[model samples]
Target: MPLNEDLPRGDAEYLSQSCFQFHEVPGSKSVTARALFLAAAARGTTVLRMPLVSDDSLGFAEGLAALGYRLEREPDRWTVEGRVRGPAAEEASVFCRDGATTARFLPVLAAAGRGVFRFDASAQMRRRPLGPLTRALRDLGVTLVHQEREDHHPLTVHADGIKGGHVTLDAGLSSQFLTALLLVGPLSEQGLTITVTDLVSAPYVDITVAMMERFGVRVQRDGNTFTVPAQPYTATDYTIEPDASTASYFLAAAALTGHRVTVPGLGSGSLQGDLRFAQVLARMGAHVALAEDHVTVTGAPGGRLAGITVNMRDISDTVPTLAAIAPFADGPVRIEDVYNTRIKECDRLEACAENLRALGVPVHIGRDWIEIHPSRPRPAHIACHDDHRIAMAFSITALRTPGITLDNPGCVKKTFPGFHRALNDLRTIWHRDQ
Candidate 1:
């Protein structure tokens, strides 16, 4: 498929005919990119198996190439030769196209170099906030000049050696800020100690720590204080896990439609924090069975759904999936503690509520929380707003009701490039062009 191809809506009924199955969903692109960068910074040969072969991962690889890392790609493995402490290509400009992980993590990667590197991206990536990361970098002695907005992307980062010291970061907006700093802290000449105030999405930080350990770095945490030891990342073979966030859609399908669905490659011992989504489904009256390597979700009998009120700060990525199935529940579903949704690919809270309202679902949106009330089913076409989560979430709503159409379904390529195909593997329904 071309980069800009439109993903047409196939018949929903056709989807249900085939059970969605994959031997292994590619490794976590987020983890792979971070690990690859760490390997590149360690000046050794790192062999990565099952690395995420998506645009985001590709962007990170490109950034590493620009930074002087030699990468050799095979059929299913990658070998990266790290440059350790060296200057990147003088004229290298990293074009991170709408990949926030690359855009955020690359700044810390570039902070250890001596040359100036320009970072630009697609319009959507430019709109995402880089203020927290930029501020943290500046505090560590990295000179960054904004080519446009003070807090946005398209900036020039002139590296002047990192003077790592104690710094306070506000993670109320996104956890990526803290993750960026944590990934690069050990490589700094002086090591790093960080204090976080009002941190949100702490689980993601835990992920960063776990990945850092996999690459041979130890991060000590005492309450709000994080200490990064001065050690090089070890070159080792690592595999990324299936994305728990992407699995939420299939899990939601089973909950809403009374279908039994099992998403393979994710297990009870998975690393992704979003795997807790099965517990949410269980709370909503779905029967959940967990085995060693798979989770099976069956909808409540007679469609007798229970309402839920929960705090989703840790698993905010599953919000869209949960919100899409909210109307099917017996009563109101209230989700709170996700204020960071406003700064994601889109303002998810408002976009979700507005898109639900467009389909005649009663939704009350607050600053950081949303309450959705179940009502009689009314079908309508939904605008995806070029947000992949919105597109996937609304499509789940169409499974039970008719007249639900999605505009610009192609937005799902941002994460699950085969989202529509996987969706088609679960259900059969009508799809009409508007």
Candidate 2:
């Protein structure tokens, strides 16, 4: 199953399937971005091992360099020279490609120092709102001026340093809002205390705090309020776990194809909320093994999976993956409480529904939920909407149904660059075994 020989065209239908023993996935984009922020604010050089090197993570690393932070990037490790005082450049312009972490986290990072920094992202990212995070920064006495849109990107931070204090935030839109403020907390004059009225993806905040502790900062959480001391981070060599969200594709693939796929480095001890996607598969009648350091998903015999109604607000990133597989389930798959998907990269709920409909699957769309009816999927070209999750998730459909294509398959560079190649390799192995 050589990519060029087996596939008819670029981003065409996939012609592979198999039960691979294991796969090595890239590092977590969420962890890598947070580590980059923390390392830049630490007291010593930070060595990040196996950090994700995709567009999003690289954009974050590049944003740091644009702000005058020293970084030495290699194949396996990246070393960032910490500067407690923030950006070395007095004036810098950063283009945050298509990464929400880069767009959301970098401006506040610049505010913790003395510099004039301008931040902008791709047109696609510019449409996402950051009003909550921006408003919180202003409340903390930081001068932030959005060049084009308020609470949106193409913004400038007239950095005179953040004298951080207690602030109330609404993290319902994203947890990165809270994590950004948290990463810069230790650098604040009075430290930082955040009282959150609402928060989504709470587990990501856990990852932020746990990673912060490893960098020598303790984040104290008393219910909804999180407190961080004004202490410099002690940079150390950190190892990033495999991205759980990215692993969702493989696990879901196993559950869909009656194959067994094991992903190393993400298990009971991992801090990603998306790891719960395996449990979602379990509820859908897949056999799942969650060891301390690895997770394996084996499909039910004959790939006969039961449909399930699950609320996916916490692990909403994998909603597209589930949506792609729902048509094959024993019953209609109803995924609820995932309104946040509408705001990511594209209106993911609508995108998933539209693509499902294209494949002759009946889909009902609500304000915060999508119900996908069970049916035999027809061959169709999927419109990816330039969202990486949309492309990667729908590619799973091509495994069983031929003629599936992606309008923008390259959009996966936002996280996993070699997604298609990796999936193809798995298919080749499965074919060989058969």
- Deviating ranges (above 4 Å) for candidate 2: 1-19
lDDT of 2 by residue, 1-434 (tens): 01122111211111112246555588999999998998999999999999999999999999999999999999979999999888899999999999999999999999988978999999999999999999999999999899988889999999988887899999998988999999999999989999999998888898899989999999999999999999999989999889999999988888888877878788677888788888888888887766666777778887787999999998999999999999999898999998888899999999999999999999999999999999989999899989999999999988889899899999999999999999998877766776
RMSD of each: 7.1, 7.0
Which regions of candidate 1 deviate over 4 angstroms? 1-26, 428-434
Error of 1 at 186 (Å): 1.6
Q: What 10-residue stretch in candidate 2 is worst by lDDT?
A: 1-10
In terms of TM-score, the best-performing candidate is 2
Question: What would the TM-scores of all predictions be?
Answer: 0.90, 0.95
lDDT (tens digit, per residue) of candidate 1 on 56-132: 78878888888777998776788888765644575468898878888888877887778888889888888889887
lDDT of 2 at 418: 96
